[model samples]
Target: MNRPSLTWKLYIGAFYLFLFAPLLVVAVFAFNASPFPSPPWRGFTLEWFTGSGSIAGKPGVLVDPIWLESIGNSFRVAIPVALLAVLLGTVNAWVLERAEFRGKTFVAMMMLWPLVIPGVVLGISILAFFSRVANGLEDWLQTDLDFLRPGLPLVVLGQLSFILTIATLIIAARLRKFDRSLEEAAFDLGASRARVLRTVTLPFLKPALIGAGLVALLMSFENFNTTLMLVGSVAPLPITMYGQMREGASPAINAVSLLLMLGVGGIASVFALTSKAER
Candidate 1:
């Protein structure tokens, strides 16, 4: 292998710095003793992550009710979104990659349309469509549908709109490379279609499914634009953090950012390891 030139090495270093500098700053600030997440560091302290509100009235991320509730809501939305997206995405992937049908290309394009649309537009579209449905139902059925209102369900649906496309793409990429002979061999051994799917196909797709699910989880957890439009009285972590920043940032926000970084990094690491193991 040819060695990289000095200039190329410097370029790579600069690229990495640009990518990670902000993250490094956030992580460093998370440990800062100061109330604000800025320069002129007061000193090193775990106050942001573990301090009591009594200590200068600055509550830690773990102890703060707002942060806890928002984090919980983010998880509440993300788990369902990831599960539903992965389940539906797997079916879509199978249909797109395995089954032959008329207008297959068109169907695939339509399924992926959510990804091309801006997040704000997708959120607003879902909001409007559902609100209209809710209003019509109220007039027709003489009752309200709370689920149709702006809430966790809507937030989950909004995130899933684009996330489903991502999950489909991930699973489809893996499914495309799957060997059909394995399924044929199982059939030759008199395994039923369901059994083949259960024992062989699902196992083969496990890594991809896991990857898609984790990516979906991360995306759902961090999602803001779509969630912002559909969120109910309770906000997700991103929306909560945005609110805090707008009012005034605290070092606790940096702590939350660091935790998010760790979470996202852990998911990426798992995906990498799973892919490597599968290979």
Candidate 2:
């Protein structure tokens, strides 16, 4: 095999450094013993990662409760969103790929509109629509509808509006290469449609489904604009971090960011390694 030229090697190294340098800095500061979360590190300590109480020197930090609750809230919203998005997206992909219908192009374009639309706008629209519907319901039914409040369900709805598009695209791409003959053969052999989908179709789409779910989960977790607008009283992790930063810069925020980055990176690495092994 021909070796890469010196110039190409330098470019690749530079590209990786550019991508990873900020993350490296954040990780380093997460362990920094200095009161300030920035440069001029005095020493190294793992207190940030271990402490279960409030952040040192910050009374209102509520590091344990706020951060932990936010993390839970994020997952609570994200997991359901990802699952629902995948189920709906997979069905949409199957229909679009297998069936010839009028206005198919129009339906496809509408499904993709969420990706292009700004998150802020989408959030605002959803909030407005829901608020109107909730008010109508309260007036008509004379009962409070708590689900419309800014919380897990609202976050999931906001996220699913866009995430479903991603899942649809990924699963649809995989479906394009699927052989219809397998399903036909299964039918001829008296296998049920559901059995064929469970045994044959889903296995082929597993990688894409996993990848899409991961993407949806990460996106839901890190989402700021939409979550900010849709979330009423409860705060997710990103919003909490932003509020903390706005109030006053703290190393604890950096520490949390670093830990989250590590968690996400670890998951991605495991997925990659497992995928490679399977191949």
Candidate 3:
């Protein structure tokens, strides 16, 4: 094959630059000694990541309670959201792929509605619907439905609205490629349906399950629109960072961005390795 032309090389270079140049800038600024995440690079320092209150007169991202709490909140929402989304998505995939049910096409299309809806719209809809339900229940029964309020539970549900669809798609794609003969053979060998599913089907779907869970985790962690609408007193990392940015840009924000990059990169790496091993 002929070598790539200069124009092709230039296009590829530009594409990657567009994709990663901003991230590179953020990574660089995370180490900047200056207060702001901008140039006139002051000498490098670890203040953004590790400064003590007394030494730098400002706490670092690791030591700051706001950042720490926000980070904790993010994991709190993301872990459960990932687990539930994957579990439900797996069930949905199995039913859609295996069960010959009426209105199956309609059900599949309806499940995809969440994926097509804008995040802002999904967030607003969940918030409004839950708020109304909470009000109605309180009026009728004089009971408080605290879970329906704009808090971590609402935030988890909001993220799940769309994330579940994504997980379903991922798992269903794998399920579609599965050979029914494997299940048939197992059944002929006297294995129970549950045993066949647990041993053969689940083993085959492991990669897809893991991939969907990791993707869901990352999406929930980075989600801002739905979280913003549904979050109560406790904010996730993305929400906290947004508030910080609105006040003023700071190197500390850069530090957080860098950490996020590392985290997302790590997850992606794990997925890649898992996929490779499966292959």
- Name the regions of candidate 1 deviating beyond 4 angstroms: 1-11
Summarize candidate 3's per-residue lDDT along 1-279 as a digit string, tens digits.
Answer: 499999999999999999999989999999888877889988899898988856556789999998999999999999999999899999999888988989999998999889778899999999999999999999999888999999999999999999999999999999998999998999999999999999999999999999999999999999998889999998999999999999998888999899999999999999999778766
Candidate 1 TM-score to native: 0.95
State the local distance difference test value for candidate 2.
0.82
TM-scores of all predicted structures: 0.95, 0.90, 0.95
lDDT tens readout by residue for model 2, 80-193: 988998889899998779889899999989998998999999899998899899999999999999898666688789989998998899889888988899889989999998
Highest-scoring model, lDDT: 3
- Error in Å for residue 243 of model 2: 0.7
- Backbone Cα, N, C clashes tallied per candidate: 0, 0, 0
Better of 2 and 3 by TM-score: 3
Which ranges in model 2 have alpha carbons more than 4 Å from their true place?
Answer: 1-15, 52-55, 58-63, 273-279
